[model samples]
Target: MHAGPRPSILFVTDLAYPARGRRYCDEDIFLTSRLREEFDVALCHPRDAAALLDGFDAVVVRNSGPVLHYQEAYDAFCARARERKVPVYNPLTGRGDMAGKQYLVDLSAAKYPVIATVDRAGDLGLLPGAAEYVIKPKLGADSVGLRFVTPDALAAEVGAEPDGSVLVQPRIDFRYEVSFFFIDRDFQYALYAPHPEQRWVLEPYEPTTADLAFARRFVEWNDLAHGIQRVDACRTADGDLLLVELEDLNPYLSLDRVTDEVREAFVARMKTSVRALLH
Candidate 1:
């Protein structure tokens, strides 16, 4: 190995943002601690990233909370990074939730195994019928502005939504929600919420080949050359997985719930991935 000063990384995060179930600060703290072994790392709030990221070899945006919280600042950071050609860990080319929820509607229309979505209120008939439907802002994240409406009220509620501002889908009665975590194109570990009612109580998941295939389909579809991605899906009563969301930017890694062996492996893979980016 060539000897040189370790690469400096500007780690972007919002440590104080109160996430409902996950500890954004704890995950980022642990990750940075591990990363520090291989690189010179520093933390900065999302709003500060544009100004602070200039001198770093790369920037890793982790648990930075929803960009909507600081849309203008986040946009500026992305623009500046592009102009300066500074490497972003999860490169700015992500087209999944990193962009917005519009991908759900596109994926659904493409006949993918995704929650059926329609952007216009008049298109509710396009989706499979259900007792209730989900209405949420297209730019929303972390369950922000998410709500359920019965079919009777869905039309009116959606009709009230500004054009192209929200998406509507049937409220899936799912078995469990699971997530497949990845670094670049590599699969890391998986986690799932056993109780639908408690979204935060996650357990280690051992994915089957079929499950991996399903998750991989979306990851491959996203086609990012670098960066972390979390493919979130809901297993239905019929045991089929439907895409819930694809979180490519700042997907939380539940490091504590994973075995120490797994956690270390992830860190190692991440270091390899980041190193690959720097190279």
Candidate 2:
């Protein structure tokens, strides 16, 4: 147990958020219940976080849902957090999905094992030839504004984004999707979906050394000194892992799917991370 006065944490979440295939409220409720044992925990919606932050020792963002739904408010919260120098879990400096989808393009350019991404028409050639290509907003989440276009329609689709606000990638033919969860750079657990079309029917995954190495590459590249991160990837037909995304900001913890022992360990690690952040 912590010896000093318990540090107060403003746990930010949207309890009413109706996420498909997951209960945001249940996850946040369970997490906060455990966290309350070690800190002064209070729940607030993301829109209210900036207003409520001044009174807390730190802010813990969990299952707040996609910031796109409340972009203006979320941006304000970020600005306020920066102005106050408030320590936000998953720190705002994260270069992964927290910032935007641009990291996909950056990683692909660096020859990382990520799906090829391009925003401009000229660079579209870099992507492997596929019958259909994916087009998604750079700021999109939860599959928002995602569509598949044929090669004939690609240029028009690319040209339609006058502001260059979208990214394009080849729709990868993959065997399955998997996610690796981490707390403060330590691998906690892994989960995977056996069916490519059914993403949320997750089962506990025991990652091989090669799988761990692949996932760790992005975690290490993200370089977040503290906080939780989820490395999402897909296994190709050729048996290689390709990064799908690195979710650092409010990544949903599918806590319901893991074993009780794994959940306990994750909660313990999170408490340790929060304590480390406070001191």
Candidate 3:
């Protein structure tokens, strides 16, 4: 508990983090601004979190960039938070991209609706054949270390890399990409990129019953009782939604794309989730 009254919240973010089409700073600024209305919120970079977390009652990790950029420091922060039994907003139970892309491999193996993913070259047979394959580091985010290879080059590319070092998936021809934003297990809103090439130019999406079901499968599969999770999926050419990634760590909400009413509702949901976390 804070010395004063309101539960202090250490909102973790990297304001200067550069992204291709997203403004990392703007989103955090909007969230922290709204969050401050209820709780005592202070902004801190991810690297500084471990040292400063002791001052706050709880820590909320948002848009701190890929852990790949600060692996050692992030590990230390997580270690210290757990060691001190700090109430982290995400509850440290995140098993999606928060942990790594390994969940995709696991989900795919279990016949989940995720894009078929495999680590070893020999396991290529398990994946449905496609003209091209997407290979990326198991521990990657923000399109970092992602690659595309022809079927012939796929074997060499994957084989040259260490097994489990990278993930391989078929580059499906999809109509569009959509992201479902959730506060805890509650659905907030969805946004979709109508153009595949222009992935960041997002617009409001009205999810169908099946679309919501497709997205919910991963959210439920993640097994987290709290935390913001973004289920990013691609609408395949066959009119089916396949999970691209489950972003539970610090999913960029793209609040700027939604209506004010929806955005306000989302912030309210987040505040409620935080209040619940504190109490």
Output the TM-score of candidate 1: 0.97
Q: Write the per-residue lDDT of candidate 2 for residues 1-279, one digit (tens) a residue.
A: 224598899999999998888788999999999999989898999999989998888999999999999999999999999999888997898999999999998999999999899889878889999989999999999999999999999999898885768999998999999999999889999999999888999999999999999999999999999999999999999999999999999999899999999999999999999989887
Work out candidate 3's RMSD over C-alphas.
Answer: 0.9
Error of 2 at 48 (Å): 0.4
Q: Pick the candidate with the highest lDDT.
A: 2
Report the C-alpha lDDT of model 1 over 1-279, residue by residue, as the tens digit: 224588899999988989997788999999999999999999999999999887888999999999999999999999999998999989999999989989999999899999999999777789998988999999999888999989899888988875879999999999999999999889999999999999879999999999999999999999999889999999998999999999998998888889999999999999999999988
Residue 60 lDDT (model 1): 94
* Residue 142 C-alpha lDDT in model 2: 93
What lDDT score goes with residue 117 in model 1? Answer: 98
Is candidate 1 or 3 superior in lDDT? 1
Stretches off by above 4 angstroms in model 3 are none
Name the better of 2 and 3 by lDDT: 2
Backbone clashes for every candidate come to 0, 0, 0
- Per-residue lDDT of candidate 3, residues 164-199 (tens digit): 789999999999999998877888899999999999
lDDT of 3 at 36: 92
Lowest lDDT 10-mer window, candidate 3?
155-164
User: Lowest summed lDDT over 10 consecutive residues: which window, candidate 1?
Assistant: 1-10
Compute each candidate's TM-score over C-alphas.
Answer: 0.97, 0.98, 0.98
